[model samples]
Target: MNEQKPIKVILVLGLFSFLSALSGSSTSLAIPKIALSLEISSGLATWVLQSGLITTTIFLVAFGHMGDLLSKNFIFFSGGIAFTIGSAITGIAPTFSLIIIGRIIQAFGSSMIMANSMGIVSDYFPDKKRAQALSYISMFISAGSISGPAAGGFIMSVSSWRWIYLINVPLMIAVLIFGHHALPIPKVSIKQLKSATQGANWMGQGLFTAGIIIFFLSGAIFQSRSNWLIGLITLVVGGALTIYSFYQDDVANLPWISPKILHNRPYLVSIMALLLVMLVNSVSNILLPFYFQSYGLMTPFQSGLLIMLQSLVMLVLSPFAGYLADRVNRQLMTIIGLVILTVSQIGYLLYPAGMNLTRIIIPIVINGIGMAFFLSPNNALTMGLVDKSLTGIAGSLNSFSRTIGMTIGISFGSSILFALLPNVDQITPALGETFLSAFRGVFYVAIAISSLASIMVFVRYLRAKKTA
Candidate 1:
């Protein structure tokens, strides 16, 4: 019965993880349809997506702290209810404003779930089994990410775009019912909760949340148009807010991210590397479709199929990587993964004009294997560095880094791409050669960023050796 309990927990939590991923990914597919249906500009419609990403990223750490102070069960159940209600509202939204509101609600709920899910897993599994269980969570994330676009596309073809959201209603209901029964109650007490609240720096938390939202919101808008007014104003203000938040932590009784955790050499370096690597990898993924369809003369379908291979390789290797992380030197494995990823980017860079597709496949495969190795092990090591009590915040901090990295990566890459092009808004055949040149430049940036990550990992290695 005890054995069965653990398995049930994984299944239920894994379902929650899947639904969350699907919700995020599928929304991209719905954006164009939404613009057409609502008679709105694509630029305005994009706010529907940005609202969700902004809220989710900003609230993760706060909600993770809530999990620690109160109970993981409290956050997860509330998230489920909020997520379900948000999805229904989104499905039935008559106007774009309502859709944005629903997405914000949904994103807040997702933050709660995201902030607590890994913490629960870490708490449930022993050290020996923790990485393996985390690997399954990673796999569920991959499955949902891979399936979302295709599933959404199919539904939109035969039905209204609203069905993309409506379909999640039943799925969330299932997760809620099963998760309520399967997830164990944490042993948090009201006394403990009160103490935690008293100790927490509420002012710092508020500042941090506001800063993150302002920063990301400005960046998202800046990506489409170089609107310096809103961009510079928000950027300066957000930066000030963030700095103040960190300063407040120095005086506060309890900081959102502990100074001890921030000061830890391996964990700090690992996080920097995670952000850089994710940035590079995301830029590569976002640009590759353009490379294939625009330059290589491949169809959209062919481009998607080719890119899907990366996920397939990740799916195959993630479990093995998790197993190896448990047995091997995690830092060593992570460094190796970074090296492999850098090599793959070089492969992309070196592909001769009019080269055959076969050469690209090898690099893509290597890229996948590298990601599989790095993500699971690095995550394990980051969480391991922190004490068990702060696991929830640690987990959310790790997740937030990835999300922020991806967001910034796309914006960075697009800005550079547009800057190099003859026209910022549209691409024409006259600019094919120009676009290819810009494309190559994007890979150069990726390679440089990835190489930087490798250097950081190697520095950690040297530091570890010195300490030893």
Candidate 2:
């Protein structure tokens, strides 16, 4: 067996992983510009962002199963190629529809990479080192999360929105080259590979993806129509598909998320906690930018800068949080993080509409730090709850939970804002007030969810102690 240094491999893999995540957040800062340039409605333009997320959400599980069946290196490299191609297409696209298409392709590539990145790390590192390695991965994600928006804004200010997509090509090429040289090859007998490939739950995957797509599409369509019959039909169809998907998973021997992991108390709790975190995180992200631009009377550039503070705080704190999870009680760390998040949400709710940037900056930073504290440690705890052999499945399920949460949060938050606004056609002072009120409501909901997650983690900790 080769004793190739794991850290070096992780560092290389981590850089590519960071870029993969970076592509997701970078487009957020360019939304207004893209909307204006494309002459698309803001709601429609949102699909440019949501398209990637929806694609990623659908494919995460399927890719995870593929990772387990195929070589991780093959999957990773293929994803890199797809991402690069998609970026090139997006960077030069003259039409908005083409851009959405590229985004979907990019999302597909991202799912492939994300589904297996942690699994690869787990395969390479021992348990003692795994948390630290995962910590590094989280740090990269934090860096991407913070930098992507800022970079997108800066590029858009100086050039065009297309540059945001253009920037990925060189980065991806470098990753592809380095990955080819550095990634270790997996050795398996042909019979083993065949069995693994054939064993995948293809029917479950199809049903799950079909259910998610139908549900989202139906909701999007139903939003514009006032016809109750049409709305009811869409709703019923979507509901049926979702129910059927889950029924197949539970009843059949093959399931999208392994029944074994889903049934575990710790694993289920971790999924719930992660879901809440993502919901809060995505809602806050959407609300903060809109709040600053509309209510705080800040320009898009200024709002982007202010948003960067949260990402910056995350970048600084995530590694420490990861290390702490290894040395201290992870459950305690999660609860503490949730507490800080709750405080941050309360701060946002209570902030005066006319407050200066300085007054609110502290709370924003605090919120970011809270996220940093939770994300890495929570991820570690979740994966740690399962056996090493199940890392791919666990990682995919975790990503899926976060994606679903983000989708629901963004959709629900936007719906509330639009419903509350008296005049949806124009941005006015009263509209701003309505939006803020909706944001306040959303934040309150976030606090409740975070609290529930904290309680779940606490209960899991007590159970673990009792068992021990």
Candidate 3:
């Protein structure tokens, strides 16, 4: 590695990752305004978020494998170019369908960046400094997550929602220029290149994509039909295809999620815990905007401000959390973070509809701190469990788990709310009672899940100690 130049390259790529990551959530705050302008229903507007997620879900792992097979720098630059074009499309889109299409393209670009970012870091940093480098990258991610909503709100307040998409263009252009110059290329011998080509897993990629499509489609079916039988069949079919893909990869020695990583006890347990953490965090994020808009009787901007509070807290605390993780017992930090997170969720459940803003802000800040604590440690531990050779795959798996968890959490949380408060029409009335009941139900489920995650962490800790 060309040490000095490579560090510059890694920082630039990290910035690219940060910006792409921000695009997803930045548009989230604009959803209500966009829906109103386009005369679309909330259900339809939700497609804006789901479209990006679906695209990313389908392509993340496949792109990760592609990164390993092709040049990582090439894939990263391609993602940047694609992201810029998609942003332009979204900015000028006239119809809701067009916007969704743009979002899908944008998500595809984001997944490309996500799929190869860790590999870029690994290429630049030696083993000793890699943890700290990862922590810095994670800080950027946390910053993006926090800044997106705030930036969205500010842009929408001053200009049209289109500006949110438009802003990414310049950002992407900068990334393209910097990345093209800065990204490091690994030299490979002709024989090594030939071996890599033979090892690439095209079939595994196809099966994984098919399985994700089926999984998402099945979710849509469940929402529409509300029938257990149909869901059961879908689940069985999807599960079988997923299993078959795994079996093929194992037998073929292809680049599907390496079985060795999955079989590692610490790695598996950490992934599960990280999934649960993401599920709860994402559900809370989705809920907060709805809570402010519907129950708190706030405008879109106000609701966005409320959501931004958590992100801001996360931005401030994440670097410290990452630093702490380097020195402390990672599992202990995760457990403590989850406990705090559960407590904050409970606070949200208990929040009276008519309560003052000050009261709500306290719990929101607490939730944010918990999130900051959880994300860094959980991520550090998950990555630390694997050898450097599999970092790209491990990162892809981590991203996949979080995406799956977010989808499940949002769906399940919405289901709980609908099931509990079927009669509440406007979502503004009975300010204290109705919303609280529904939110409480969601919290109960989240708490249970967090508790289970805690147990898993403890068990892993004990086992690790014994082995040591």
Candidate 4:
């Protein structure tokens, strides 16, 4: 397995991960600018981001299936090129609809990259060193998150928001050119080859994609509380379709989830842990920015700096976490990380309103440290349990879990925040208490979720220990 080191493969994967992360975080920063330029409401402008996320959610598993059947290099190369084209479209779009179309295209490409990168890494690296390679993947993701807001702000200050999308083109081209010679060709199993020849189950693909889109659409619409009938219909239909698709696949003796992955208890628990973490993190990501800027009265740049602090901590600790994952018990690392994350959420919930930067930084920094400890090791553990042939679906499932969690977090958290403080458009002395109350309610829920994740990890660790 280790005839040639996979330095280049890891590099290419890291860059792709970086691009995806960068675009997500930066887009949030550009939302206001985009709204202003398009003469659209801020709420409407969010579609630019949501469209991409929704497209990614719909296509992740499909692309992962393709990764199992297609040449990994080809998938990787095509994803980069497609992302470049999508970015270019967004850069010069004359209308918001076009921008959204561009985003959907970009996300389709991102799905291909995000879906396959980890599987490709798992293929080339031996188990002993795989965690270290995965850590680099986590590191670039953190770097992208850390850089996005600052980069977006800088671009907005000097140029147009269009530059943010445009920026990805050059970076993607670099990856495409370099990755051609760099990424190793995957060794396909006979089963995979057969599946490749037969091609994917297009009907199953459509059902799953439609289900996901419907679910997200319902959630988005429900958040506004303006269209209950449509949302209810969507929720019912989507749930039914999703279940039917899963049943159909299982009955047919083939499924995107494959019985191996679906039956692995450790992998399942690990996914649960990862999902909870992303859910809470995404909630915090949405809330803290508003809290800092609206309540704390910080400048947008200043708030970006505060928001970046957590990712910065995550970036610094990811490699060290990787080193420990290789040497230490991965389950132990996960439990500790979850504990820290739960505690950090508690810290945020209890932190007093009108606190200065120092107090805000402490809890966020702790959250970052917890994330740093959790993600890479947990990822390694998840991938370690799956068969090599199933890694494509496995990687995609992991990314999809993250997407689902983030969607839930943002949708639910934003709903609660607005419901609590519907009139809170500005920071005033009298409205401060109301805002704090809403913030506390949202984060208290986040704490519950994080704590639940911690408990899940603890139980898994104990089970493994007992079995050992």
On residues 236-332, what C-alpha lDDT tens digit does candidate 4 reach at each position? 8987887687666655544666877767888989987898999999888888877877777777777777878888898889999988998999989
Q: Give the worst 10-residue stretch by lDDT in candidate 3.
A: 123-132
For each candidate, how many residue pairs have backbone atoms clashing (under 3 Å)? 0, 0, 0, 0
lDDT of each: 0.81, 0.77, 0.76, 0.84
* Better model by TM-score: candidate 1 vs candidate 3: 1
RMSD to truth, every model? 2.5, 3.1, 3.3, 2.9
lDDT of 2 by residue, 66-134 (tens): 676676667767788898999989889999989988998988998888887877877786665566778
**TM-score, prediction 3:** 0.87
The local distance difference test score of model 3 is 0.76
lDDT tens digits by residue: candidate 1, 371-397? 999988888887787888888877787
Error of 2 at 414 (Å): 2.1
- Candidate 4 overall lDDT versus native: 0.84
Model 2 pairs whose backbones collide: none
Given candidate 3, what's the lDDT at residue 304?
69
Per-residue alpha-carbon lDDT of candidate 3 for residues 111-208, written as tens digits (9 for 90 to 100): 87888777666666654455456667776776787788778878988999999999999988987877667775455577865676676677976787
Write down the lDDT that model 1 would get. Answer: 0.81
Ranking by lDDT: 4, 1, 2, 3
